[model samples]
Target: MRPWLRIKGVFVYLRAFFSFVLGGLAAGCATVGPDYAGPPATPLPAAFTRAGEPPEAPRVAAWWNQLGDPTLASLVERAFAANPSLAAAQARLLHVRDMSRTERANQMPRGGADLFYAHARLPSMSGGAEDGSQLPSRLDLYNVGFDATWEIDLFGGQRRAVEAAGASVQAAEANLADAQVSLAAEVAQLYVDLRGCQRREALNDDAIARQQRGLDLARRRREAGTASDLDLARLQGQLEATRADTGQLAAELDGYRNALAVLLGLPPGTLDDELAKPAPIPLPPTAVAVGDPTALLKNRPDIRAAERTLAARTAQIGQAQAARFPRLTLMGLIGIGGSHLSDLAHLDDFTALAAPRLRWNFLDFGRNAANVDKAEDMRNEAVSHYRAAVLAALRDAEDALARFRQRRVTVATLARAVEAARRAADLTRERERAGTTTMMDLLDAERTRISTEQRLASAETALTGDFVSLQKALGLGWAESPRH
Candidate 1:
């Protein structure tokens, strides 16, 4: 063909290719996917169910510290440093961060280099030299090349992928925050239980001592023919019951001690010596600064993590939808190759090539469509989960609030009951000393007072526990942990 004709043919082909690419570019921009809209607004209550006017209280950001216990604060810090669950969450956060970087790199140019050498010899049956008189000989060839590839985000597929990855990192970080919250709650609850058990154990000890005195008096009365055998047996039975109660309380104390050690990531029994001594149960503040429910969005890590997961899933739908469209990639390479290594020394021996590739999934039957549908379903599931999390958190807070209120009331009532019983017992003791009341009356009065005091101790501990639960429901204490 003539040169002019060949030139015309080249131009015609170039025009057709450009026309195809232009059409693809327009279609690529018309990406098919549903954009994410936030979940529907949920109506929140104006105030908590059991809101009350309490004495001015400290803020609950680090609610654990509000309890005013140095040992408990130190334990929270130790758990932050040593809890295995928190460490695992941190590791997951790092891994997700690196994965996000990997996804982002896909949208940018990626380059690599390779240097290679090969040695070869002709087969014995093949001739290596042109003269045919020379035998086969080995040859050395050197090659070096650098290549780069870049994927254009014409349809925003890679952009969606990167967005999804970033959301995943945020979700992972939220998971770490959630772990911190759970860890602190666990440690604090165990600490409260330990103290409560100690308190109950001491109560049991006092009850047993009081009964021992009653039994001694009954024995003297029986020896003097002033008390019946049935009365003496009754005293012994009561004393034995108190002793048994002490045994159970001691066992529970041990269980709490071991559980606390585990929360601190120490061997069981490691805290035996530290916790063996009895101490006052850490009490909650007289009042609570529980912010309104709107704060749940910011304060609750589980909710935040769930929201981020939904974001990631929504981005995945976009990525999957983009997969059904065309993708364009540009690849380029520069190389030096030679039968002899000396050829690499000359710039003239250098070679370069560039290519633009188009990949269209026009005939995958239904794979791309299926992926899009799957992603959409997954996104829908995430939405449901997010909503469920919100509802559940609200329910938890409301329920905790109600329980804390009732428990506090119960503690106060018992406090009054114990005081009244103590006063009555004191008057009865004086009456018995003045020979106005019988020995049996004095013993019964003393037993009632001691039992009432034990009940008060138990109720007070429960009130403290309920307060902790309320703080947990509000997601208030996790920020107290280091860098949650």
Candidate 2:
């Protein structure tokens, strides 16, 4: 054959080979196993049954800001930036993203350049030494080459692997978001508790002061023969009890401060000076907007992560099924080397090689079949888990809503009780000044007012805490700045 004709024939052969490879890939695009349509839908109510108000769109992202407390907002932001758990979640997300990228790279051709040098000595047979003299007893070899390999995804196994990896990456991201939601809620709750404790402590201080004054008066009256020992003892006992309650409040305040500091990734007592001054509990808006159940499914990170996990598991089924088929790999190498070291300089003396390898474990004692069965089982488990997640999310949101709504009612009732007690105390004080009521009557009325006020403070704190829980259930706080 003519040289030009030979070159043309080679080009034609190369073209045909590539066309076959491409056609195979195009046909193999139909992946094995059942395709993932989407997450299975779970039945949900149109609106939360316990939602007191009309359903409206919830401002779930950055919901902490809606509480109208800048300090709580700042703490949440700080926690997001520094909390150890959130940092760990972000690291997990990064790891999965890198793994996903690696899976994608597996779909492309792989090439490497290699250089090898070696010296070897061969032993001669004593009886055949004269005949062995024709062969060299020692040799030095040097090789430099570029080699390439590409595994054709003829059954879309590699493609399914890549798909699974991508879904895993999304799941990791959702996990990170869930961490953020939890962290923000934790910080806000701790902050509210701290403020509530401070308020209680302040009230306790007033009670202790008033009880001391009353005790002093009772002692003076006893000394003057106007009061009995029983009266003085009762006054002293009340003072002691109030002082004991103050100690408990102090401990609670310290604990809340320490917890808040830790959530911000700071050492215990770090926030003491900053939070030493008492502040009011952050209150929720009058009309909380909680979107429908469908919105909850989309917003909640746990649900999203679960759904992604199901998708990844579904892809794994296809991957396992594909494994039962054959794999095609194309390998090629080009190099130059010779017996003499100087021969390495002769570029024209280089050798070239190419091969296509096909492998199939046609009989592995049903191992591939077992793998496919396991994969299908895993997918089914994932489906169950995803449904469980959806149900759990809905239950959580509804529970939070119930608690918040009831807490609001409790707070309102307590506010009314506090108001009535204050009015009674005012009336008692006036009656005492008019000589119609005794000092004890005024003292008792004042105590009642303070006690009711304390209860109101506690109820207010719980309401705010419930509000935080509701926001967390709605998957708020992950949409803030510096998102991963």
TM-scores for all candidates: the values are 0.89, 0.93
Enumerate residue pairs that collide in model 2.
Answer: none
Question: Tens digits of per-residue lDDT for model 2 on 118-154?
Answer: 8999875344456644466688998877777888888
Clashing residue pair totals per candidate (backbone < 3 A): 0, 0
TM-score of 2: 0.93
Displacement of residue 183 (Cα, Å) in model 2 is 0.7
Q: Identify the candidate with maximal TM-score.
A: 2
Q: Which pairs of residues collide in candidate 1?
A: none
In order, candidate lDDTs are 0.80, 0.86
For model 1, the stretches where C-alpha displacement exceeds 4 angstroms are: 1-32, 53-60, 123-138, 480-484
Q: Please tell me which predicted candidate would have the highest lDDT against the true structure.
A: 2
Kindly give the stretch of ten consecutive residues in candidate 2 with the minimal lDDT sum: 3-12
